[model samples]
Target chain A: MTLSKRIIPCLDVTDGRVVKGINFIDLQDAGDPVEIAKNYNEQGADEITFLDITASSDNRDLILDIIESVAKQIFIPLTVGGGVRSVNDVRRLLNAGADKVSINTSAILNPELVKESSARFGSQCIVVAIDAKRVDDHWEVFTHGGRNKTGLDALEWAKKMVDYGAGELLLTSMDRDGTKSGFDLELTQQISDAVEVPIIASGGVGNLKHLVDGVKLGKADAVLAASIFHFGEFSIKDAKEFMKNNNVEVRL
Target chain B: MIAIVDYGMGNLKSVHNAFKFIAPAIDSVVTSDPKVINNADRVVFPGQGAMPDCIREIEERNLKDAIIHAAQSKPFLGICIGLQLLFEKSDEGNIEGLKILKGNVCRFVSSKTEKIKIPHMGWNSVAHHGNHPLWANISNHEKFYFVHSYYVKEANSEIVQGQTEYGQKFTSAVAKDNLFACQFHPEKSGSAGLQLLKNFTSWTC
Candidate 1:
């Protein structure tokens, strides 16, 4: 009855389209977010996360449209985030077809939002995403998309988020993000061990081996990757098979 | 008609969408009306949020009798909070459950025997008690999407149909006569999820 490790594909959606603003591919055109999510689901992604990285005022409608379209086409669970500030925002996204909503900057600003939303929608549907960077032998929490340091230690913040009623933690290493070097194993394990909640190791997934290491070494309950799956470096099926072979206990 | 009891929690659309996707002509409905829910030949109860809130909605909507009646008479399915409500009481909010079955809902504890996380959120394997139609075609290793802090602990073990493990082995699914319930979210559990819902459509008491 062991729970299988999960592999999640993260999409940085902006202005109603998948943001390929990274150097991986020149997706100058508005890549259909729903279509990309569908492809990931078919490729055996355990779950798909749509991070609303857009700062547009009309971004809510676009994100809702994406959730509706993908929820109908794909059968897996969908998590949406970005610009979610209040409990109403969580309801809006959940009603729009999201199984869970990840709150980062907004949660840091008003910690009560996590408690309110969790009490209203259940902690299972609330995820607290933390963007952390190693600083002077310790990790510092970042906000506003990893720009402003909040002076809150990542380990302490992780515990606080859990105490505040967060169901899961999506920990992203700012330095490893986009570099594809690999996730910060020591940091991930530190947080995973610190809090009993599930840890989703995001950023720094450079290769197939990184996915396996996420569970084996970092002890993350789930591994979230972006450029690798988005750019077709390797499919979710490939990663799951690799984990299954490495005795990481993944659903194949 | 299939009535997905809308006691004002969880996602009814996901269940409706899954049924509609599987059998486009399936006459499935999400209704809070006690008469409609009780009259349906097949009923599915899917719920999320807090147990006390869910129970409040059920009582406020006059659905307590309807849900209990349907569970006894019709082919019923309960999910997540819907499943927990079948027990006697929950440690969450100190609320009394429907008490349709004999058991108690306890919070996941990290004890000396075994340390586990609360809200066991993720995919986990479910081992069925015996051959059951609800699990038809779903393999033993097939993982289902789950997100809950509490679970059925000291259930009438005789009725516990399926069990899963996080830090310790616990019941995940239960069935007796016409009632079938699980802690995992089939609507969010990918292919195996759709398959289970499809099986429910064809299952008979």
Candidate 2:
């Protein structure tokens, strides 16, 4: 009767290959993006997200080609993020079979893109990604793979994106990312309470309990993890089962 | 042959690919051409985005009459906004719909104490009614992917094939004669979705 909480597997891709980063550095190649995505789909991932970390315009077409092939096979919601700069990028990614397009740096650079794209495409397909890091008392938004500081309060940025017609927010803690120290509960809880739209907790999911904590403690509608699932440390079913055991409603 | 009526609003690739995956031998194409939709043995009216814009595109493309005609005569299938367009009107933009079915689309209302989000996104189970051909292989209460802000209301209870609950219980599926429609995206709902498309491929009624 009620909506089920989502468990999304994020594939960080660079130059058409899937790669994982530790603290946004120390890039490690996992495998082919297409093959890896298919594996996750088979493992019953609620949705698949492809973060194109490739900083070059030349490889944009490569990600599109990869998306095309995967879209032909996988039958789940696919979200594409990173390097999305304009409305044209949103259209291209959607045309290539992305169910949703997540905007990060471009959203911070030009908030109007969120309004314009959501107006034309509808808010359901536009996801605003806010990369945040702890700065003294509050979390500040970061851009360019968590490299540059925007000096915008993370909670304020999240509210602004929703006002700009973003249907969802992908909140990642730069501090907990890759450390697997579990999600920053305070950060996730604060932003989730502020926004009416669904929030996906990202960055520091190290185990199944961390995933459960993201839902129970953080109040996120969904949780995203990499490396652990990518490297076969645990199956997606294991995570869902664990969450279900802990009273979280998940599609099994 | 199946013609997925793409009025240029939502993702048509998933629908086209789902049909191709389930029954490759059948011919399925995403077309905006009214003639193609009218000629196809099965018609799929799939849409997303806002209802007013969807209505605008349908009118702009000159597909309103052709779609209404096909819905009356063929094994028609409508998904998401496609389902909404079949109603008489929608609260979104206060625009009128195709009026094939007698009802209006209303937005999900949440009071201060409710706190339910708008666009009820994500997966939820559908409680189907009776025995419709579309529910052949799909079990009752099977989960399906849904993303929408408005739902059909004031619809004839006789035509309601499935219902789902979010903030309130709403009609999620309907079947009138040969026309079958659902508010969920079976194309993106994994195996259950594929099976629904497969059933539609062979669905005669």
Candidate 3:
């Protein structure tokens, strides 16, 4: 019963600008991370997740600054992931006021890292993120920013992580990453059904109906998207209203 | 003035923001200080995260007695986890609650439906059960944003002001003399949510 339907907004931070794309292409600057997070906070976003999508060293510093600035202004729970590799990285983010630290590449490289961090900081603070791509009709776990294949089945890895004491699972489908078509329901359902912890479904969110579908059909405890929210195409308020109309319970 | 209890749990800023939007003149502060709670015109308890942690923080800050006193003396508004804590106890943990409202917090039984999910997160319609000032300007069938798996099952149904249907109709809002609560997050709720805050602010009860 720890699972709550979460309406989350994802911010892709690069060089201090919030950027988003389809399949990680056609990159465009959306807005300031601080400004966007503030708006989402005011509009009632359950949580805000920031993904450091940039590779530049300078952008990394900028992302940290963005986190610090946004943390000051926002009061809701804030989660930051991407390019996070060590406990130091996690500590830095937490020191910057991040409520939860999400790990993807590091967890895939050393699955034991999930257990180690969970043991150190408590399970509720550790969020293991998984990126998957369809290979030979089988969902394969990917890492290194979704650019490399791990040759591991997504569901198997998710179950393993839970056994390792990861508190929550953040599952993102590479194929659907930026298409805005909809969430990969089959992938999301597989992880959700396999794991006991809360699952956050990310990738391919187009509109409010897709958000509702993510929770209702995909069985996700929360839905995360970047483009739709950053571009002003859909708002957290309108999205929650649509979910209400459709019978998807959100905190109003 | 509204004293927002700071129990080191989920977002209290958004709750304060909602109050600011609705009643700009309403004073709000996040503090565990008893003197502040005693001085406020009203009280708002908004919760996020776990219930056990919230209860512990309230006790650690020595605000338990103050919260109970405030509930007994002035208007109180509890939202989400805040509402769940008002009950007799919660299955979330073995910790005892404020017992201001008579009920036990239980998990949503979604096994009854194939489509319904737990954590019942999102916006859903609230069906009014009784006339309360908190419902003023809030349509009977209007929607509110909810994000929890557990709800209060009042020992006394008379305290329930609204109910919502997910797998089945459960209490969405409850009211007793000088005390009110909603399982939904009125701050996160949009315009209608703001209206509820406004109504609560202006209510004489």
List TM-scores of chain B, every candidate: 0.96, 0.98, 0.96
Q: Per-residue lDDT of A1-252 in model 1, one digit per residue for the tens?
A: 487889998888888888762333333433888667766777788898998878768656789988888888788889998899888889989987898899999888999999999888888888999999999999999976578999999999999999988989999999898888999999999999899889999989999899888888998999999888777678789988888889888877
- After superposing candidate 1, which stretches have Cα over 4 Å from the reference? A21-30
Q: Flag regions of model 3 displaced more than 4 Å.
A: A1-10, A21-30, A33-50, A54-103, A106-128, A160-169, A178-185, A195-201, A204-252, B112-116
lDDT per residue as tens, model 2, B1-205: 8999989896799899888888899999999999998899999999999999998899999999889999999899999999999999999999999999999999997876776766788999999988999999898999899999999998999999999988879999999999999999999999999999898888886
RMSD of 2: 2.9
What tens-digit string does per-residue lDDT give for candidate 2 at A56-171? 78877888988898999889999999889999999999999999999998998899999999998989999999999999999999976689999999999999999999999999
User: What's the lDDT for all of these models?
Assistant: 0.87, 0.90, 0.78
Winning candidate number (TM-score): 2
Candidate 2: stretches off by over 4 Å: A21-30
User: Ranking under TM-score, best-scoring first?
Assistant: 2, 1, 3
TM-score of each: 0.95, 0.96, 0.75
Q: What DockQ does model 1 achieve?
A: 0.71
User: What is candidate 3's CAPRI-style docking category based on DockQ?
Assistant: incorrect
lDDT of 3 by residue, B9-126 (tens): 7546667766766677878788878899989999998876678878888889888888888888899998888888888998887667888878898876646344454456556778
